[model samples]
Target: MSNNPIPIVDFAPFLDGSAKQQTADQLLGSFKSYGFLYLTNFGISNEEVQEMFDLSKRFFALPHESKMLAPYPEARTHHRGYSFPGREKLPDAGDVAEMPLPSVKETFDIGREDDDSMLNVWPPDHILPGFKELCLAFYWKCHEVEKNILRALALGFGLEEEWLVRHHRMPDNNLRLQHYPSIPLESVLTKKVARISNHTDYASLTVLFQDNVGGLEAEDPNEPGRYLAVSPIPNSVVVNAADFLRRWSNDVIRSPMHGVRAPQDMVTEDGMLPDRYSIPYFCAADFSTVVDTIPGTWSADYPKKYEPMSVGKYMLKRLADGY
Candidate 1:
């Protein structure tokens, strides 16, 4: 068996309109193979990425008492705020009730804007002016890019390019920020770091923009229990279809289960520091969109056995259970 490299798609091809058919064919190959692709030449600037990280560090630096304002389980919109470990359980595995507890990670969430209005949890103004605006601007930037990428995905699947984009629940989507700080050196001395156990994302699609630190790993199909590193490349967004998309595609594409490791896996580089910051945009369809089978893809298509649901309802269960 060949360990072929996953195709890296350049959005420029489509943007330039120089070779659309070729671009679409490449897109389709990526969709069918791993359902994940490295999207480069997409124009998301490095300075912009650095600014996003700098802001995240500032937020995380606020005293724990200050950061507590947006605590999880209490945030109604499930949008903003910091999440301590154990607050989100993994929903797709044996009931979240049965899954092992989550890791020691803190996250801040944001969402898309609509009608010039985007929902957010203010961190009491005098403390941080334009903080929300700065973060949200980055959120919106990723939001539009996500839609464009989805348009490419639809083309890859031989479906109308806008088919999935139109189906997305506007601005209700998530722009989640996470900080997997270097486990304290004392903890390393104590062997107490509790990293995120293995898991896959729950949204329809995820646009992950990670810095140079390389702890993210996916299960090696040929070597169970072992993991293959998802090394981050600068100036590119890591894209993957999620569980909802897998179901919607009738399992034609699967949600790849990935997890992180402790610092031992670290490969030192000039750009990487001990701190690992991640901001992923989870794009989803309206909760009401049913995950049904595609009719023309296979020889014997069967009915969708799953029940219909709105994305919010499903996410609530996942979060409450701890995803």
Candidate 2:
């Protein structure tokens, strides 16, 4: 219903030893409140982000037949490759009947290439000269950033700095390139389809590089039915806590529901909206890692809300439920 009041924090201090406690405090505060924030000076260059977006555009521009080379469901098992529009439906987190429309976005997913069990699906090198290399590079850079953020978050949670880093040694992270195609206003009003339906991310943390055509909205903690628009900030990555982390903290931190919808002013003279692109790096703990409440985060008054489970099992179940 309004713009987000999430704080923008400079991450440069976290890299150096100076003012680290202050940085941790800011992170903790933001996590406790909105569960989202804009992170700047996190070290990935702007040019690199732009290049990744360019490659994503090219990939999405491929002919339908070509893009379908690596389709969903089949790729869903491997957790990689293309997903056409309408291929995904974000089932209401609370009730399925609340919003039955399928999400109206196309996506391409990739993971660490070194993983033998879940290999990345890439376009032929000849078709997109350096696509694979650039994507992999961006993915690794995001992974490093996630690690550093986790280090700061560990301190915020009153734990050893390396507590989270040690548990995420073999992360099951994914790099998802999403494209929400233009649509008519009438269609949106009639069908009630969202670019992406409202839901909390299944990972521990999500680092997103969104374009200026913003539609991202985060639910307000203090007001039900009220949402806050999260506009894109130049040279910044939007970071948010996810369900896994909330579970790990026994709800000490929140993983608020977020979604995408076309902004009112997005319509052009022809009544067609501009395509929106976003690349979100889902930072997850290792598949085999069993997630439980952190030491200082739980008490007898507030018992652990989640049963212990492996990250892999939880992620697969969530993915299956989403489709």
> Residues 1-323, candidate 2, lDDT per residue (tens digit)?
14458789899998887888789889978998889999999989999999999999999999988887776546455668888898788865444578657788999998988898787777677776888788888988998999999889899888899999987888689999999998876776565676776789997999999999998988889986677889988999999999988888888888999888668787888877789999999998898878777878878887778788898898878877776
Q: In model 1, where do residues sit more than 4 Å from their true spots?
A: 1-4, 73-79, 89-99, 113-119, 184-193, 263-273, 298-309
What lDDT would candidate 1 get against the real structure? 0.67
Candidate 1 RMSD to the real structure: 4.3
Best by lDDT: 2
Expressed as tens digits, the lDDT of each residue in 1-323 for candidate 1 is: 02436557887887577866677677656656666677887657878888998888888888887777766536443555667754654432323454464466788887654522334555765566677898889987887777777677677677887877877746457787788765553443342444565677777888888877767766655566666667787688888778777766767775777766654546345322277888888887765555445434444355554555566677655545554
Q: Rate the local accuracy (lDDT) of all candidates.
A: 0.67, 0.85
- TM-score of candidate 2 versus the correct structure, residues matched by position: 0.95
TM-score, every prediction: 0.83, 0.95
Identify the candidate with maximal TM-score: 2
The lDDT of model 2 is: 0.85
